[model samples]
Target: SQSSVDNMSCPSTPSTPTSPIPYEIQIATEDDRESILNFLQTFFFRDEPLNSYLGIITEETPRCLDLENFSLKELNNGVNLKAVYNGKIIGVSLNGILERGWLGKDDPYKHGDTKFGIILDLLERVARESDPFKKYPDCEKAMTVKILSVDGTYRGKGIAKALMAKTRELAKEHGCGFMSVDCTSHFTACALKNLGFELHYSLKYVDHKVNGEVVLNPAPPHVAVTVYTQKID
Candidate 1:
């Protein structure tokens, strides 16, 4: 299945699916920051559902620093993973460690009125209301998948699944008790569900409004924002 919001930043036309290539999953390091950023810019920024819905990136404005910073904020956390094919980075799972009582600890208005700020606000609301920490109380820390993306040509080839599986392993090694992912894209939600992540919370876009106007109206097959989580065993 295609696991990303927009075929994981795939080109408009996808390549044939029969050729399965060998790829290695490895931890992304500091030196790989620029490569990861460049990969995300090419494959993730333009096609992510919310970014597409809000026109966050356009011909005039090709980059949104807010989102880019958000994606890279936890790169040095040692939980991020990348899939490489012939030395080319084709997939990424940017993850972060979430401690208990992490909610309400930051200034929600830090991004302030920007489109990416709106997204952060929505995710914050989910994290607060769902309170995954509360659900998995025995554990004081959890590993959260902040971003999951794959090259479009590699879609339906299990790249995303591999990335997520590696993330789960990393969570166990990092002493986390659970793994959580806030999925804004339907495809990602479905993929995680198939991998045994349970639905913790869900908020429909229509219900999330600002000034009575629905701010994000993603296309069909992408409806609500959801949080899916699984315990680390």
Candidate 2:
């Protein structure tokens, strides 16, 4: 009987669960900032060096925590999912726009006709493989799916998929057609692929030694993956 319970899926529709182990998904508010940070800190450091990439520290200051709050606040342009069980925050999902020209325009190094041509070629290749290009606002105009994270305690319970389905639901409601995410973990990538995401491009980085010195360089370029799903049936 206990195994049967594990096989059951949460209610597909959005609402608070009524059972004893109740769970609810709702919009995250400013008051949830501390809980959000605590949840993020759990996963932010699992990969050692990569955690450094996020600029997170074990001794987080109140100001740093506030910055996390600010980032979430700005992402209000998209869907933010918070899963609450027993009146405590247990999981979260943040998805929003990845605007076109946002990347190329921000990097001053890629200016002028030559650099523009190279970057544009890359963008075109990305656009060709991404499903976002064919949907609502067009992939080049805006990105639908972006960030998804689930708490550690709740892993292996299908919570991630539930949150993703909720994201797709929100994207459909917003009149957006496609979604994409840059995933670093193989588990995350494989899960997205299972949900119909495809690989578009991938670039590896290597820290190496050259001529008795050390250097960091981009590894051979590879394909990037894109996960695409039509929010509407």
Candidate 3:
């Protein structure tokens, strides 16, 4: 496990995995910011419902910006990972630990470059209300998979799944009691379900309207925001 720790934030060109899909997992560092940002901007920077709902990446949508602020702090928290192949980052997972009373506190969301502060408020409220740890007693450790994204070219290769698998191992190594993932992508929800994470809470897109006007109608398949959790052993 110390090996993983040493690899944290280090850009070492290590040996590859034995699997047919050759990706090397390592903890990301500040030096990898540009690479990570560029990769995300090219793929997941504005790919989510919130961003898509506001057209954050388009040339005409002057109302918003990308979701870089979302995971930058998670990297500082030192639990993030990068999946690389051929010296290129193909996937990433931003992770953090949630302690007890994590909800009954000041919101950690930074509102700069956001499309709407209201959406953040609503998300925070719903996430707090849907706290899975609230149902249990003496549960103090839970690792939150804050963000998971993969390159479009590598979508069907289980990159996100492998990144999540590493999250579990990282959680277990850090003595976390469980792992939690907030899935706004329908495909990701299905992935978590296949990985045995139970859907702890869900809010359909139609239910998250603003001023009675639905803001997000993300293509097809991505119909809801789902929170999923799986206990770590």
Candidate 4:
């Protein structure tokens, strides 16, 4: 259910006071695309050579995913996919409105639709393959957390926790009682768990072969465990 954004609007919330690092957490806009991409490039590719998949897209892809064109309506309505620090863009968390009967429908990944379709396909497969679905009470909810990331340089500095806090705030602001995330990294899963997020189920998929060897990538499934704390309450 993670939809795209078209245009981004600056957050109405007052910017938090500067700290030693002078970090600022705000809703991301299209203007922040370059920074976000740069952050991702550094964190997932440059710093962590093990995660080259994060930089799979070209320059054009970021524009398509920018908040200026795809999910403009949601952005205006206060659906926040934000960044942290002085435009360093250390983190991102995005969610989308859910449709009724979404779980019963066939996988939305067809042929075209590119980015959106790819994500839908990934989620569909993950859901079908994962087990222990009962723990994830929010699976049937009408919203999905599409992205959550932290820059490598900023990792271990509590930025991830801040990002989760903001994400919870956004969900509550939108009156969404449920949220979900598809985690592919151990760090992400740990962060979610530390924030009290519970595992609904996990899917291991053979996405592709690397270095002529097949690799099993375990995708962690998560759902909102609590309302006020955004933890697994």
The lDDT for every candidate, in the order shown, is: 0.84, 0.49, 0.72, 0.48
TM-score: which is higher, 1 or 3? 1
Which lDDT tens digits does candidate 1 get at residues 1-233? 22333233312223555567899999998889899999999998888898899888899999888788778876777889999999999999999998998887865346748888878878777887888987887999899998899998888788998999999998998899999999888878878877888878787877788888888889967778888889988
RMSD versus native structure for model 3? 9.2
Candidate 1 residue 48 C-alpha distance from true site, Å? 1.0
lDDT minimum window of 10 residues, candidate 1 = 5-14
lDDT digits (tens) for residues 44-89 of candidate 4:
4332212223333446453334222332334433455665666456
Work out the TM-score per prediction: 0.89, 0.59, 0.82, 0.59
Q: Candidate 2 lDDT, tens digit per residue, 9-104?
A: 322433543233457778776667667767766654333132333333445532343335433554445467778888877777766755544433
Q: Give me the candidate number with maximum lDDT.
A: 1
Please tell me which model should have the higher lDDT, number 1 or number 3. Answer: 1
Q: Which ten-residue region of model 4 has the weakest summed lDDT?
A: 1-10
Report the backbone clash tally of model 4: 14
Show model 3 residue runs off by greater than 4 Å: 1-19, 60-66, 108-118
Ranking by lDDT: 1, 3, 2, 4
Q: What TM-score quantifies how close candidate 3 is to the native fold?
A: 0.82
Sort by TM-score, best first: what order? 1, 3, 2, 4
